[model samples]
Target: MWALDSGICNSLEQPIKRCTAKVIAFDLETDKTVKTVDLSDILKPHSRPQYLVTDYSPNGFPYVYISDAEGAIIVLDIHHNKMYRVVLPRAISAGCGESDVLYLLLVRRPKNQNMVIFSYLCGNKVYGIKSEFLRTGRGSSAIVELGSKTKHSVLLGTDGSNGVILRYRSESELYKWNTDQPYKECNFELVQLAEECRLSTHVAPGGKDALMYSLSSNVADYLNHTCGAGGASARLKYISKECEDDCY
Candidate 1:
């Protein structure tokens, strides 16, 4: 197994001769250093000064996905005890926050095909793409525009077993994709919250909990044991935001 750390050198190599932040790779088996690579050539300047590995594959192969702040991703293939960098597709936006871009390592059941799913935000629009482009580094299929352009957009998690979930400001919707067929339109359902309820959505680790926040009312609703899965039920509880001294 291998791990990656940005802005810090944990490998055996000395300091890299570059102005950009350094990315270090570590071998988890021996807990020793693996190799270090400079981000200057991979990512643009003033971009995300740090990079972290994403769990894209479940197998025992030492494949790590490292991403920068500007929505650019790199695949580090650690085979034969050597590290190689593979450039993946990147998001191009004239204006968009770094947080608006999301990358997920997804797997198709039974066949066990590994693919990277990415969503890029441009203004109020969100585009999703799933392909082997990450592996071959080119010829990625065209981007799929998601829903009507909403005022706000958030790409939640998808475990392949369930479906894809997305939140547009106050509205959350679940999309089901048939993995057996090619890319096409998906079936969707809007998750009900409350009247005129506008909020952001967050899924806890392991998709155990789904959190919905209404900043206007300083309130949050916790959906217990729900991760926006297809046809999965949810339980809602209202909680007041904790203030400096008052809990209301």
Candidate 2:
């Protein structure tokens, strides 16, 4: 498994400057750390970095993409032990202030795994770029304005295809849309967990198959009635139409 080390910055007044973040990998069978990649040197001064591991390359190279909250992404080639920084175009980063959060999601094309849809949510808008362009460290002009959602919308995950999953903060239904489809037409309801309250939902990682697993819990009862008072236990549900299969 892979995990990030945000470093020792929590107690410091100026936390960003003291962060010594790194990424670590572990062996599952033996439960031992196999590798540790220090990222302090490449990260922007005083900036904490967030990272996501991409699926193995078509050529089988392992890659890790890191963002330092700057308008750029740092691509680390784990196989070659090299790093490249790719800056986002103004079309994607323009007007986004320093306080705004940048959310990145990697969605592979169903037809071609070699092609990756790199999507980032900044403010209320989501933008897309081809991963190939990012790998080349080029400022791509092919950036696509995927769509915009209400400021209250939360990005759930991808559909193991081109569809981006999302949900309104006040709603309990999950909605999705293919990147190629019109944003206004992205009202396809993927699932509805509850009618009265919004459930906390999370899509599991590793989009290897058509079937996706989601974990959900009714947290409103826990909040309103107190911990363990009326809250529902977390449940695992399959995203396929055969919802009754292997649910727990």
Candidate 3:
């Protein structure tokens, strides 16, 4: 199922009627339920000039790609609001783009050095991508960085390519897996890893052939509840497995 982050919770009422902040949540395909959570209530945002970064966890949770004034990735306990900045070796230029698959790319190229490790919080798990794997000035503009998916096995994808890699974009790089192929340029705007790695397209379960109950709504209509990825963190509320097909 595909989802976006604009919803009623992020809406304002009058002349000052609009939230500048983006609200996040999830949309389940089985039942057209737009599950949204108010982030403002979840995290305290400072009212100062703060550089921002954002990415979605594997299951579509907004795994906030947070950073600080000094270009350092901030690791935090989302539920408790505690934060610790994991500084990269040097300032790295980065951007967030996803492929046909579900892996998020955190491509960082440090200006001062040829290596930079990526660090950030996603699915409530702290992760790191070292610079050795991402040799900055390498022959190929592409580099294979590794990490795991919501499913445990390690996943690797090419970051940055032979394109106009914005030299100034140093916040975070998001990617998706479409297939096992190393990379395939996406016709879609998002940076896709390949067709093999893309997450399965979801459709509402209906009719007699339907083993599950799918909530109906435009994929764009509802906010999806982010199920923290790979079961790495605390369990979010699980409603049931009573559908035609078990979902456990």
In angstroms, the error of model 3 at 180 is 15
**Which order, best to worst by TM-score?**
2, 1, 3
Task: Give me the displacement of residue 193 in model 1, in angstroms.
Answer: 3.1
Query: Tens digit of lDDT per residue, candidate 2, span 24-78?
Result: 8899999999988888667776454654546566677777776555666777778
Which regions of candidate 3 deviate over 4 angstroms?
1-17, 20-23, 30-70, 74-90, 93-248
Return whichever of 1 and 2 wins on lDDT.
2
Model 1: per-residue Cα lDDT over 1-248, one tens digit each:
34434454522247452344555656777787677665556556544433343333345544555544465556555443333343334434436675444334343344434444444444434444443344444523544544444354444544334344445544533333333443334344443233322233433223343333222221233233333333332323322232221211
Which of the numbered candidates is closest to the native, going by highest lDDT?
2
What TM value does model 3 have? Answer: 0.24
Tens-digit lDDT track of model 3 for 167-207: 00112122333322222234112332222111311212233
Best by TM-score: 2
> What C-alpha lDDT, on a 0 to 100 scale, does residue 161 get in candidate 2?
64
Q: Give candidate 1's whole-model lDDT.
A: 0.42
Q: Each candidate's TM vs. the true structure? A: 0.48, 0.73, 0.24
Local error of candidate 2 at residue 3 (angstroms): 2.4
lDDT of 2 at 135: 62
